[model samples]
Target: MTEVLVVGAGPVGLALAADLRMRGVEVAVVERRTDPGAGTRAIGIHSPALALLEASGATDGIRERAVRIARGEARADGRVLAEIRFDRLRARHPYVAALPQSDTIEVLTALAPPVRRGVGVTSLRQETDGIRAQLDDGGEIRAGVVVVATGWSGRDLVYRPGAVRTHHYPDRYVMADVVASGGPVARVHLERAGVVESFPLPGGRRRLVAWAGTNEVTDADGFLRDAVAARTGTPVDIAGASTFGVRRAVAPALRRGRVIVVGDAAHEVSPIGGQGMNLGLLDALTLAPLLGPWVRRGDDAGLARWERDRLASARHAARLAFLNTMLGRAAGPSAHAARTMALRTALRGPGGEAFTRAYAMRFDRAARARG
Candidate 1:
């Protein structure tokens, strides 16, 4: 029997499986999709996440394929409002590494246990000694522990008997990849009109994300081109475009009996600050060490501790991400001015380092512990 059965083969599940296997635990991973997801998603890999990737021996490969961003700038009306210098960060990997989520998944998948593709856990029931997972393909898996990393799909299976609370923001974002001529500084333009963000990706490609109010954007390329040119005075050659909604949710608990949740399964935050994937990666790193004892001794106490700690950390990270979304999507002259001034003070004042550290998620005990 597998010691642990991971129900999703995304970055979170793959990271967990890799960590567990490295620790001598027998693990299996399952994914519903036969092929990997395409496109560049979650472009920012913060320092803490880089540390976790290093532990799994995946950072070197990822670094070779990622762009290193030394600082992040917030601007309005073509003027810089605030700057967060990631170069001054205390971590070993100071700068945020900009790589496509697909590439990150490739690195993790290479290090993880071989995943069973086109197969998904349909349902799970806790047994006396282990959890029994019903697969979509008429197969069943029984493992000492089951980790549901399906992120939002299997919430009904893993949430602790209570409804998960979710707050959906009115904001929508149109994102696209573009070829631009600029330095490697990640930038956010909080204009009175909308929010436009640019992050340098590997190759000559850069990712641009712009807040598109309630109106549906029919032409993403035209929209991004106008927005990027207007906000940053930088010309962009649009490559591809997509849209996504902004929302935040957290399960009441991260553990249910012999099964636990990680990544989007446990919580979700807005992509404003690029915290979602990094938070999930940290979840895998922090949860893996606790699983060793639970698998060997059936220690429910350790699982309980993991649940409490991770939930708190997720809440904290989600709050930060929400704040970022609010600042970026600030509308109207009064709100925009207030946000610009606040950000300027926060970034240029004595508390700038603390603010940047917090936003970068360096203060999380789990992240610091791994570092």
Candidate 2:
């Protein structure tokens, strides 16, 4: 029997599998898709996440394909409202590494246990000694422990026993990667038009995200160009475009019996701070060590502790991401003015350092204690 069966070979599952295998735990990973997703869903990897990846020996490969962003600027009306100098952070990777999520997936998949693609967990049932997962291909997996890292789908499939609350913000945004020449700095513009943000990716490409109000944008290319021009005072060539909603949610619990959840399977936050992937990586980092011990010794107490710590951390991250979305989606002259003033104050004082550190997810007391 497999020591651990991880469902969904996304970043979280892959990271956990790699960590557990490195620790000498037998593991297997399954994914529903035969191929990796082409979209660049989450693009920013912060300092703490970089540290985690470095420990797993994946950061060098990731950095080879990623662009290092040294600073983050907030602008309004073409004026720089606030600046976050990532260089001020004390970590070895003081900058945010901007890489396409596809590349990230590649790096993680290479490090993880061999994945069985086109295989997905259709249902899960807990037995006396382990959890039994029914696969879509008429196969069943019985492991000492099961990890649900299938993102939002796990909310219904795994957590149906309890209520999961999701708060959808009225904000809608369109994102695209375009060919552009800019510094290694990420910028966010909170203007009356909307919130237009840009992050530099590798190979002279930049990712642009712009708020498009409550309505679905019909012309993503046009909207992206106009928003980019309005926010950065520069117009560039568009490569591709997509749209997404801003929402926050948390699972009722991170663990149910012998099965556990991680990543978007357990919590989801806004993309404003690019914390979704980083948080998911942290979840894997946090759970892997505890899970290995629990599976080896049948230590229910250790699993319970992991559940408590991870749940609390997820809630905190979700709240922070919601705040970031609210600040970025703020509109009108007064709202913009208030945001500008707040940013100015926060960036100029000690509060600015705290904010940036928190955004980087380096200020978690539990994480520090664990380290």
Candidate 3:
């Protein structure tokens, strides 16, 4: 049997693979996709996750490639709502990096060699000693441990098909990421109509994620023009467009037998807080330490510690994702009252920093733990 089988090539799987390799553990990763991501979905790498990447000896590449947003803001109508500076909030990694999910994965895959693409896991059986997986390629692989990073694809392995639990909201957002050829774009810019987030990637290309509407945005050009028009009263062009749904789902536990779930598989969230990938990254830190001894001496204490120590954090990540999504859709009388009071008390003054810091993962205890 192999040391470990990681069942996805996404960021979570690759990251876990990297951590395992760093600890001198043999690992193999499988990706169902034939290639890297087509567009940018997950953006904004926070300070905590940056530290994790740094520890893994992969930070220099990402740091050199990504654009830094010293601060971020949330706004409404024509009035400026809240502007919080991430650089000043925490001292570790002073800025938020704006990069695409593809670039992030690319960096990670390079660091972690031998990711099997176009390979899908079909079935998994676990015993007291190790686990075995069936690949759609009509092959079998055995490992002492297997991590089910397959995302929604692995739901059946844990629960009945279509039985995964999820919480969603009515509000939706349209997103687009493109290379701005003109000049260095604004670090973090948001208007009442929506928000524009930018992060530079390797090869002089920058990634941008913009949310132009709360409801279904019909006209791509119109939304771009309107977003710029509403914010700056000027015209702007949207060179590329990509749109996807926003959702939140959390499994009760991240592990069943030797098969463990991480990243989008264990928990997924709306893009409101930009914590989805970061949550998965944290999974590496929290779970990696648990697998070292298991691989070194064929012991299970390290693996058990991984589950025990990481469980609460995983649940909290899902819970926070839920709260952030709900807060994004907060409306009607109750939401209005809350937002209004928030605007009156916090958003208008220095208290505005508190709201921003809380969301930026700055105000939390030990915010540098890969989340």
Candidate 4:
């Protein structure tokens, strides 16, 4: 029997397998996709995650292709309200590393074992000494432990009574990646209409995200361009755009019998603050260390504690995402002014550094202590 069978070959699963391989643990990876993806999807790797990924030698590769965002600016009506400098953080990786999800997967894939492609786990059944996983390929694999690292959509494969809870927010946004020159600073425009955000990308490209109220938009590019030009006075000629809604999901228990869950399959948060992937990556990092002992010596003392700590981390990330979406929501002129003043006060001096640290997801207990 395999010691550990990891489902889903996404960033989280790949990361977990890589960490396990580094520790000399017997790990197998499976993915539903026949071929690797090519798009630059999720784009932020924070300090905490970077520290955790150092063991797998992924941090250096990610930094090579990523744009380091060391500063964040909050503006309104063409005026700067406040700024958060990540460089002030007392950590090894102070900046939030921005790389395409595709690039991240490539970096991790090189470190993990060969993944079995075009196969999917249909269901999982807990056994006395192991878990039996039913695969779509008409075969079953029994492993000492199984880890479900699939994303949010793969929740169905491991469904149990009261396993997961989900909630969707009414917020909507239009975002797009374009070839433009925006310096390596992340800028947010808190306007009366809504919020307009811009982040620098590699190869002279930039990403723009603008709030679009409750109603859906058909012409995402036009709406985004208008929102940016009207609110931030910056005209953007985008080739295309996409719209998405935010949601949060959490599993109170990450493990059921011998089968465990990690990554988005275990918890999912809004992408407003770019915390979802980092949270999952940290999950893999923390779980990898514990899985080694459990699988090798049957020492499961840390499993319960790991679950509790990871649950708390997920809740904290959800709260942060909620705050991010709320702060960027549309407001009246009076509310906008009040919010601007509040931001200025909150992001000033020492508070700004603290905010930057938290935004970079340094509060997770498993993260390395800052020097």
TM-scores vs. true structure, each candidate? 0.96, 0.95, 0.83, 0.97
- Model 3: lDDT of residue 304: 59
Candidate with best lDDT: 4
TM-score of 4: 0.97
Model 4 stretches with alpha carbons more than 4 Å out: 161-163, 368-371
Runs in model 3 deviating more than 4 A are: 77-79, 178-218, 231-234, 296-299, 302-311, 314-341, 347-357, 362-371
Q: Clashing pairs in model 1? A: none
lDDT of each: 0.84, 0.82, 0.66, 0.87
How accurate locally is residue 356 in candidate 4, as Cα lDDT from 0 to 100?
A: 81
Instruction: Give the per-residue lDDT digits (tens) of candidate 4, residues 1-371.
Output: 88999999999999999999999989999898998788776898888889889999998999999999999898887888788788888788889898788999999999999999999989888887888999999998889899999887677767765568788899899999988777899998889998888888888888889989999998998898888889988787976689999988888788878888888898889888888998998888888988878977899999998899889999999999999999989998889889988888888866787778788888876665421
Question: Arrange candidates by lDDT, highest first: which order?
Answer: 4, 1, 2, 3
Per-residue lDDT of model 2, residues 125-240, tens digit only: 88988988899999999999998888988666676654788888888888998888777988888777778888999888888888888889888888888877867688877756
Residue-level error in angstroms, candidate 3, position 308: 5.6
Q: How many backbone collisions does model 3 have?
A: 2
Residue 91, model 4: Cα distance from true site in angstroms: 0.5
Q: Judged by lDDT relative to the true structure, which candidate is superior, 1 or 2?
A: 1
Best by TM-score: 4
- Per-residue lDDT tens digits for candidate 3, residues 64-114, read 767777765555444445556676764577777767678788788888869
For each candidate, how many residue pairs have backbone atoms clashing (under 3 Å)?
0, 0, 2, 0
Worst 10 residues of 3 by lDDT: 182-191
lDDT for predicted candidate 1 compared with the true structure: 0.84
